[model samples]
Target: MKPSDPEFQEFAEAANLPLLRTARLLTGDWHLGQDLLQVTLTKVYLRWSQADRWDSPTGYARTVMVNTYCTWHRRRWRHELPRERLPDRAGERDTADTVATTDALARALADLPRRQRAAVVLRYYDDLSVEQAARALQCPPGTVMSLTFRALARLRQSADLHDTAVEGR
Candidate 1:
């Protein structure tokens, strides 16, 4: 089938939800996720004529999304306001403990280096194997494994510190 044929539409329809989910997890924000996906899809559509020759169209789009996301903050700042503490406890539907833990995890994720964050999201959250992530990242499988390992270790340390701080309160 031609790359721009109906198959592309079908594939896009099937991929949308999973791609959006991955984007949201990668970005830690829904709005940014949508923007990321939009950019990815636009790029893919522009290259649709080559889709017939791609080893994996889905993989190409995923790699494009990640590369685009990584570059976004480089050219300009998104103007996120950084604060040491929230002025008020928002998103309070959950128990205080759950909310605290979730908040700490989000902060820890934001603090991770971009490559490490990508490794963690692709490996754990997106459930990609080391080999698959390596392909997406254009790196050796060993590198992907190392990146994920370090990311996980850092996350564990962050969690431990958060736990200790809570206990002291």
Candidate 2:
């Protein structure tokens, strides 16, 4: 089916921004995030009928994106290179504090082990329930709870986040 199919188009339009945000967090790179989102959308397009039948289309898309991300993580060829310099920004200097907090959170997220990061993203960022996150991660709900606890602890312990919080206050 074409991407312009009404059902697929509607789902894509509704879920696009949240999917992109989740993808960016999963991949920790904007370009990779875009690529991931494209792959996700293509997957959704191929399975549009089944996806359309899902109770929560956005949740299904998120599951696909997370699973795809985990697959990419397992493959060595899909490496995300660390950048030595920051990307250029536009002239607007508004919301500097918000930007810094986001950057700090992203960096801390990058430091988390893959499963922990996935759990945190699914549970907190995606606002999935423990049972839901567990299903998405293919683990038990208790594991999701533990992973969320540990991930949040790690983020709290991060000196980068600590410094950002101190400076933001």
Q: Which lDDT tens digits does candidate 1 get at residues 31-52?
A: 7888899999889888888897
* Top-lDDT candidate index: 2
How well does each candidate superpose onto the true structure, as a TM-score? 0.78, 0.78
Question: Candidate 1: which stretches are off by over 4 Å?
Answer: 74-100, 159-161, 164-169
Cα lDDT computed for each candidate against the true fold: 0.80, 0.83
Off by over 4 Å in 2: 1-4, 74-94
* Model 1: pairs clashing at backbone N, Cα or C within 3 Å: none
